[model samples]
Target: MTERIWKIGTRGSLLAMTQTRMVQELLAEIGVRSEAVILHTRGDQLKDKPLWKFGGKAVFVTEFEEKILSGEIDMAVHSAKDMPAKTPEGLVIGACLPRENPADVLVVRRGNDFFGGGGKEKRGEKKADPASGPRIGTSSLRREMQLREQFGLENVSPLRGNVPTRLEKLRTGQYDGVILAAAGLARLELDHEPDLVYHSMDAARYLPAAGQGIIAVECRKGGATEALLRHLNDRRTEVELAAERGFMYGIAAGCHEPVAAHAVLGEDGTLRMRVMKYGNGRCRYFSGEAPESRCALLAEELAGQVLAALRPAEEEEDHRTGSRRKDG
Candidate 1:
């Protein structure tokens, strides 16, 4: 009897292909044969514009998703952060691979003294010029807002490209520094660049985007591919992703919303989650913990609280505007 080879769909980018190949290797270890089917997505084609301008992060997954729905592919691998808050109907995340470090990292060019002294400041060291702040490159509004509000960086510029291309830009001194996901740098083994200085952000202070650093395998609900993927799912990662994604959906956040959520499962079977929403030049945060079994509910409750807090401020602003109009 001949064995069947499953087709795993993935984006054409090096990072996407590398992640998909990791899944393929896992399947191979389990005695399942699989092959990578590279698919170029809309996000890949429209590199000149920001993602939100077209269709947000979903643009990256739509083509692979269509192929899966049409039965052209058995499953698709995706960077979990690139997925929308809500899964499309008829498809489900069958597996979430073990997560990598989710913290964001600042990658500074070799000669840039933005940090004053080798990615850190020394006592009495002169700070960089405030009028001409270092040009930091990033594509995410979440990161950009955090950079400005949290770190006081004022010269952030939009940078769009794959991981390697971004690195190339940094190498050429196109920008003084760039912000990138630590997980991607680790996976690509690009973190050891002698010409770059790395400063990792604290995940607690700088919350990661929901589902960041996770590799998700999406398959048709209740399909054979789903069954096969179950073996690869990391239970802890699945639970964490559930809580984080639950909060995202509860808030009705789109892919490009300046929102972040991260869930951690403790050894004591408790799930703790932190969520942040950045807007109007300010940031709102909500955090909660619950038994792992009830993590989803806790996330929903926290999201509701966040929304409730936001409504009063919005209503007050509207009321003041209306009163001024009537008086005029």
Candidate 2:
């Protein structure tokens, strides 16, 4: 009997290719041979445009999903973070590989002060003013707001491109610092660049994108492809991802919305999650934890809690403003 050969679909970007290769290797270990098929997605064509300006994160996975459904590829491998909250009908995430370090990291220009605001200090201590901080670059609105609110960094600019391009920009002095996923730098072996200094941000303070650092293999609802992909699923990663995606679904978050969520499975079998949402010129945080089996429900519950809390505050503010207007 001959082993089945699978065609794995992935984007052409270096990071995407790297992740795809990892999936291929995992399959090979299980005696399942596979070949990589590079697909140029709308996200790739519009690299220069901000994701929010056009199709949100959907642009990244749309073509690949189409290919899978059309049977052009047996499976699609993607960075889980790129996937949206809802899967198209007839498609399902067959597996989520073990996640990498989900924390965000700061890569600073070699000769510049590593921290944006001169150096790290107590929250309210004498520190370098925001005006004098080095310019930091990132595309995430969540990161931008967190930087300003938590680190007092006000000079963040929009940065687009893959990991290498972003690093090249920093190397050429296009910006003094850039924030990137630690897992990406590690996967590409770019974490040790001598020209840059690395600082791991605290996850509680710097919430990452939902499903960050995870590699996912998606397939149609039920078939040989999905059955084969079942071998690749990591239970812990799937549970954490379920919680994160459930929260995203609950909130109806689009790529443009300044929203971020991170979930982790602890040794005690508890799945804990932290989520952040920016609205009306302010940021709000929500958190919850539950057993792995109930992770998704826990996430949805937290989402409801956040919405319930926000509506009244918004109504009261509107009422106060209206009353002041009438008195004046």
Candidate 3:
């Protein structure tokens, strides 16, 4: 019997909607008919303001979560990258699509050689890979640290906006090249992908943002869709994301602090987690693994490190926000 329709919920942003469409297509492969219910989130409206100034990272996916609780929607789709280290109770990630390319790329002006992104050495800085000098733009402190401090790039600035806006700015030569997630460019069909020539940095060298390149299908706990989701769930991805989010939670990374982590599942079912935290006097790396476990525990262990990083900065924050962070 053909299922008539499953109401899928997602944020109104282009990236969120794009991921939703991809999920719907995946459902079609399994003979499920689904509909997307576009929900407005505060993150979509407050484009001008930074996320921390608002309700922190909680504001990003909270509305869709509300919809799921209210029974107005059966499932919600999310970009694995934007998902925070923690999710609310009574909801579980039902499915996560096969991850896209998970590297970050440098997008430069019409004629810049920051990694020779657009055809090998145009601006004459081609003497050698100088390891330093040139401007970089990104919204992640994690990216900044990896690109600037680690790689020796001198100029790093914050670049914020939807995908199109960021690309347009790059095309006009406003920045030497901004750091963008490779997966997003491929999804949007852009030509300058990360693998093309942009220093091909590994996630180990640059711990990815928490939940990067992972899309999740979340449903109410013990719902009718439980079995369906388990069938769709990618255990390998679940393991990877779980480990990464766990590290983030450990570090207590919310909108307040810029942190990054990435996890990978090996051929033999081994899971490895890498985390980076740069705040106050701490700039450190942590790595660990679990042979067998659920996603929850993986996230918990990663969050443990994050918790350690924030111990010193605790006095500067409000109690309400600090307590309810990743650990909360």
In terms of lDDT, model 3 sits at: 0.72
Q: Give the poorly placed runs of model 3, Cα more than 4 Å off.
A: 1-3, 116-133, 193-199, 280-282, 294-328
- Against the reference, the lDDT scores of all candidates come to 0.88, 0.86, 0.72
Residue 121's lDDT in candidate 3: 40
Residue-level error in angstroms, candidate 3, position 52: 2.1
Off by over 4 Å in 1: 116-131, 317-328
Q: Candidate 2 on 241-263: residue-level lDDT in tens?
A: 88899999998888788888999
lDDT of 1 by residue, 1-328 (tens): 9899999999888899899999999999999999999888889999998888899999998888889999999999999999887888999999999999989998887776475463333211233674476778888988887777777786778899999999999889888889899999999999999988888888988888999999999999996889999999999999999898889899899877889998999999999888899744588888889998899899999899878978888788889999999999
In candidate 2, list every pair of residues with a backbone clash.
Answer: none
Considering lDDT, where higher is better, how would the candidates rank from best to worst? Answer: 1, 2, 3
Question: What TM-scores do the predictions have?
Answer: 0.93, 0.91, 0.82
Off by over 4 Å in 2: 1-3, 116-132, 313-328
Give the alpha carbon lDDT tens digit for every residue of 184-222 in model 3: 777777746443334445777766777777888888888
**Candidate 3, residue 43: CA error in Å?**
0.9
